[model samples]
Target: MKKVTVYLSENTYDVLNNLSSKRKESMSLIARKILEKGLTEEAAKDGIDAVTDAVRRAMRDILKPTEDRLAKLAAKAAVAAATAMYLNTQCIADLGKNNALELYQIARTKAVAYLREKDEEA
Candidate 1:
C-alpha cells in the first residue's frame, strides 16, 4: 500500500471523525472507503459519457450519406423544373396561341402526375 497525506477543513474533519466513531472504524479506513466509492461513481459516469459519444458518432456516420443524397435529389428536381419551364416557354413562342395553350396543359398534367407518383413512392 502507498501512503499519502490529505488536508481537510475543520468542519470536514469533524464530520469524518464522527462518522468513523459511529461506524467503529478508524478515520483512515472511513476516508479510504469514501474516496473509493466516489472514484467508482466518477468512473461509471465517465463510462456512460463515452458510450453516449460513441452512439452519436455512429448515428452521424450512418445518416450522413442519406442526408447528402436527399440534398442532391432536391437540387436535381429544381434543375429539371427550371429546364421544363424554359422548354415550355420556347414551345409557346414557336407554336400559335391555341396550340401553345394545349401543349402547356399537357406539360402541366405530366408534371403533376410525375410528382404524384414520386410522392406515392415516398
Candidate 2:
C-alpha cells in the first residue's frame, strides 16, 4: 500500500479520533472507507453520464427522420395552399366575366351534392 500523509487542523484530528473511538475503528480504516465509497460513487456517476450522452444522441438520431418528414409535409402543404389560392382567384376572374349568380348557384349545388355523397358513404 502507498502511504501518504495529509495535514489537518487540530479540531479535525480530534473529530476523527473521537469518531474512531466511538466506532471502535482506526483513522486509516475511516480514510479507506471514505476513499472506496467515493471511488464507487464516482464510477456510478461516470456510468450515468455515459448513458445520458448515449440517450441524447439516440434521441437526436430518431428525431432526424421525423424532422425530414415534417419538412416535406410543410413543403407540400405550402404548394397545395398556393395552388388553391391561384385556382380560387382564377375562378373569381372567370365568374366576373360570366354571371356571378350563376357561378354561386352552381358551386352551391355541387357542394351540397358532394356532402350528400360523403354522408351516404359514411
Candidate 3:
C-alpha cells in the first residue's frame, strides 16, 4: 500500500477525532476506512456508468441499419406520392371536370386504404 497525506477542516478533524475515541480506533485507521469506502463507491459508480455507456452504444449500433432502412423507405414513399400526384393532375386535365372529380375521389379512397394497411403492418 502507498502512503498518502490529506488535510481536513477543523470541524472535520474534530468529528473524526471524536469518532476515533468513541470507537477506540486510531484516527488514521478511521480515515483509512472512510477513504477506502469512498473510493470503492466511486469505483462502483464508474463501473456502472461504463456499462450503461456500452449498452447504449450497442443499442445504437443495433438500430442503425433499421433506422437507415426506414429513412430509405420514407424517401421512396415521398417520391412515389409525388409521382402519383403529378399523374393524377395530368389525368384530371385530360378528363372532363365532373369525371375528374369522381376519379379523384376513387383514387383518394384507394390511397387512404393503402395507407391504413401499411400503418397496420408497421
Candidate 4:
C-alpha cells in the first residue's frame, strides 16, 4: 500500500477521531475508506457526464438535417408570398389612377390591422 500525508482542520480531525473511536478503527483506515468511496463516486459521476454529452451530440447530429430543411421551406414560402404581393400590386396599378391609390391605401390599412391582430394573438 502507498502512504500519503494529509492535513485536516481541527474540527475535521476531531470528527474523524470520534468516528475512529466509535468504529474501533484506526483514523488512517477510516480516512482511506472515505477517500476510496469518494474516488469511486467521482469516477461514476464522470462516466455519467461523458454519456450525457455523447447523447446530446448524437441528438444534435440527428436534428441538423431537419432544421436545414425547415429553414429552406421557410425561405421558399417567403419568396412565394413576395411574388404574390408584387403581382397584386401590379394589378392594382393597372386599375386606372382614379381608384388605384384609394384601393391600395385601403388594402394597406387592412393588412396592417390584420398583422396587428395576429401579433396580439401570438
lDDT by residue (tens digit), candidate 1, 1-122: 89989999999999999999899999999999999999999999999999999999999999999999999999999999889887887778676666776677788899888867846546
Estimated TM-score per prediction? 0.64, 0.66, 0.73, 0.77
| Tens digits of lDDT, candidate 4, 1-83 | 99799999999999999999999999999999999999999999999999999999999999999999999999999899879
Each model's lDDT: 0.90, 0.84, 0.91, 0.90
lDDT of 3 at 13: 100
Which clashing pairs does model 3 show? Answer: none
Q: Which regions of candidate 1 deviate over 4 angstroms?
A: 85-122
lDDT minimum window of 10 residues, candidate 3 = 113-122
Q: Alpha-carbon error at 122 in model 4, in Å?
A: 11
- Clash totals, every prediction: 0, 0, 0, 0
lDDT of candidate model 3 versus the reference: 0.91
Q: After TM-score superposition, what is the CA distance of residue 69 in candidate 3 from its true location, in Å?
A: 0.2
State the local distance difference test value for candidate 2: 0.84
